[model samples]
Target: MPANIKALKARIRSVDSTMHITKAMELVASSKIKKATARMEESRFYRRVMEEAFADLAKTDSPYSKTTDSDAPRLYIAIAGDRGLAGGYNNNVFKQVKAAYREGDMVLPIGRRAVEYFRHHGAVLYSEDYTSSEKLTSADCAAIGRSVTSAFDEGTIGAVYLVYTEFVNMLTQEARTKQLLPLVPDEGEGEETHTAGTVYEPDAETVLNALIPEYVGGITYCLAAMSFASELAARRQAMDTATKNASDMIDDLNLRYNRARQGAITQEITEIVAGASE
Candidate 1:
């Protein structure tokens, strides 16, 4: 065909390739978001059960109450992502953690992103690097829970708090701070009021001591699920935007190609008609 048509074909091919890549990215993000949402759903039950267990434990008196004291040296755990592209999801929590730091606080960063971010400004007490999201397990939470409890017992640290993004909905995820130490009563507004008479057969302090570690596991699991959900949701939104932008670009290129082809065809027909008249 004409030179202009040939050039247009090449341009179209390039745009088609770009569109394929964006479409694939969108599909991948969509699948990940589904799994992440399922995980968030599963963890909700764990949070509710743990809350009930804690309420039961808090009804009785206990000697181990020292675990919840605020005057103790605080242990702060910050959860973030290892990779980016989810917009401000990780950065929001990182900044919140930095702003919340108090004098003589110890920090344990869960993801490499947070580790690198905090290594420069805060005291890095511990850093955990994972190979993949699947490799992160409840056992990791248990181990960290034990270590934090030991620190409190040994007087190395006093309180513990976690900074993460709470997934409220697909459109809304808020950076939040949660208390993990002290096994305090879940007395916050909106907390369900359970009948205290259920009887902790073992007494309040004993039940709390038993439930405290479980609460730690629950909190860690909940945080991880919420953070992952937020990441996936953000990625899905980003990929969708990219896919739309690519489609618009392809349409513009096609219009230009068609106009150029029409101009070339008109010139050739005009030349043929002039030759016939001569």
Candidate 2:
């Protein structure tokens, strides 16, 4: 009985230690989530503005609107987190990429997790320079955009897609794949029905060419921000769940320990009473 009680006490201490770690992790994730979500919001707003500009540009006849040859290879820019502990966050984006992968497709992974995953699957990489999303800067995004544009312009790839996790809410994130190249205008959309009397300074084509790289870089940054926010939110939730479960286990163990101790005391009291009656 004493041994059992001692074991239960040890288990309770272990659970308490785990709870402390998980609670600390939860707090850290919460703090990061706030900053990440704020950045994500700003990025999304910028991305939307850029998209609108590109849509308007697409309405004009330009070389960027033309599609490449059908046989050209496709490129996928997969964005994920550098680490895990975010429940299913990384896996969800990875699965979306896997579902769309093809024989001639090339991958440009933007995170450590993505690098590891693509390498393990033996996928061809566009470049190894973009391997950590956490440390990416605007300049880095611009460089990546330049590389992607160069490949597209050189006729090496026909299309480019961006794979990421869209932050929907605190508890929800959706994996999405968005087309980034060819600049195809939607039918019946952005038609010059009511012109705003906007005139291109040098020419429309020149402005479009100048904006394409910035647009791509902006979109990539936006997606990266959203992915980071999603990762932090997911990690916070996971750690919260773990902490709650540990608390419950500790409570159960404490109850069991008390019961065993009480039983031992009762057994000793009964032995004393019998000896007195004899």
Candidate 3:
């Protein structure tokens, strides 16, 4: 066989192996995305309810509804994926966070990638408890909420924002930065029309204070779920593209290998005939 033919064959084999790996990754990501999206949907419903409750509270004279001073420092809770190979999933969120970052601001990174990115840039880290996206739980979010709420209560940070990827669909994921603190009540068309008339047990202010942490935790968990879904969707799409490209390369390499092999055989036969005639 010709050396070119051998090299082509090796290249085809390498591509075939890569194709298999990418196909498997695609399947895994597909499965994970389904679960992540389902969880995201459920969390979104709960978050909406929490938001409505907060909006009603904001209508009253509760202290939680009061806006913080503009000069107060900001705290950003950034959510990213723990692993890479998910296209631009992590990068998008990080870019949004970096763009909005300012001096004296603190960062609470949720995933390992977020932690690393902020730490490398010398951002002040709030807490390192929740570092893995896959293993995040309500308890983890609650802890994070408590930490930020503590800071806000102590006047350490004035405003709080959540930086994460919003899962629109498999084909579309958007990085978003949303304010989380001071309980900005939802307004406009999406706001709930009917306000409950139920009275608070003790007082509205006390209830608002107690519900604020829970609401924050719920929103944190919801955003994390959405980010996870977006990550899986991006990974699935990337792996699928890689697998298709590998398949195309292997087909081209196989064609070249066949032509090289046929050429080598024809040359050998011609040489044998010439030598015999001589």
lDDT for predicted candidate 2 compared with the true structure: 0.85
For residues 2-77, what per-residue lDDT tens digits would candidate 3 score against the true structure? 6788789888988899999999999999978778899998888787777777777776766667786667778889
Look at candidate 1 and tell me the lDDT of residue 270.
Answer: 100
Task: List model 1 lDDT by residue over 49-168, tens digit each.
Answer: 776666555545643343544565677788887666667888888778778787778788777677767777757565454323334678887877777777776777777788888888
- The lDDT-based order of candidates, best leading, equals 3, 2, 1
- Clash count list over all predictions: 3, 0, 0
Q: List the residue pairs that clash in candidate 3.
A: none
TM-score of each: 0.75, 0.86, 0.90
Per-residue lDDT tens digits of candidate 2, residues 1-278?
A: 58998999999999999999999999999988878888888877688667766666777776567776678888999998888878898899889888988997899998898999999999989977777887878898888888898888888988889998888899988889988887756456555533335577697668878878887888888888888888888889999999999999999999999999999999999999999999
Best by TM-score: 3
Error of 1 at 109 (Å): 2.3
Give the 10-residue window scoring lowest on summed lDDT in candidate 1: 126-135
